[model samples]
Target: MAIEDNPSREALEFEGQTTVIHDYAAKLVPGILQTEAYAREVLGSGARPKSDEERDRLLSTRLARAGILGDFHSPVMWSLLDEAVLRRPIGGPAVMCHQLRHIAALGEQRRVRLHVLPFEVGAHSLLDGIVSLMWFEDLPPIAYVEGLRTGRAPFCS
Candidate 1:
């Protein structure tokens, strides 16, 4: 399938594909890797969902995106996270503890690889924002950068 920019969370898909996620999170955990409680906290603080029902629906969708990681034929996932991602306490200490443990568990999975970029690494190439690169057999590699507004662009391999 041809790759496309996905600004809408509901339409994002990695399913049974090879995906590489590199994120520099200064605020909260990355969306695809967030726990339910973590996601709710992150979303709640920023989006200001009109009602609890809407928030739940959005949270459910975020959780559903995680389904691909555990499917029968799961995708190859490589997540490179900044060390700062672990330092932020988005939903209090308990939530952060759970989230960190969850991330470690996910990293232990066969199809998932997690790398943490230490703060001592100093200046680096990817210092700007969160970037996700999706690879498919038939189409050229596509990349997405997250910021004030997400933009889909091609990252030349």
Candidate 2:
């Protein structure tokens, strides 16, 4: 599921840190790191949006969320991506090239750390879904998992 699908006010208010494990095979991207073209394609294609307008609205929201990454109190973010994510051309060659370059640029920034899990790693744990963990200064961490068309945040010890 896309971050746009999870319009939680709490997530917007969060000001701390975040860690993400992303497998593009599951059809999702780490929101703070997606390019406009890449996000447009993913959100538009997968949701079968009712109309172009709706798709644009959703895409806008998703892209807006990325703005938090640029805020003065932005969270320190780390993203681990499956190698397949770098290989997949979600929006054709030009779009993908731009997306990858964007990711590379983010890595050059001080606030984000990006890593790729090469296929050579073979099979291991966390193959079940995409996971995102957010840690806040004054609240318990929250974990969000995505599978198929749904997502859940099961908060417990």
Q: What TM-score should be assigned to candidate 2? A: 0.78
Worst 10 residues of 1 by lDDT: 1-10
Error of 2 at 16 (Å): 7.9
Q: Provide the TM-score for each candidate, comma-separated.
A: 0.77, 0.78
lDDT of 2 by residue, 12-84 (tens): 4342244332223323456556788987887667544447876676567667767776754677677778887
Judge candidate 2 against the unseen true structure and give its global Cα lDDT, from 0 to 1. Answer: 0.63
- Top-lDDT candidate index: 1
State the lDDT of candidate 1 residue by residue for 1-157, as single tens digits: 2332224252255433544444455444667778998978866775433468766766776687777777646557777888888998889999999999989988776546888888899888777777777777766666756542343445647
The residue pairs that clash in candidate 1, if any, are none
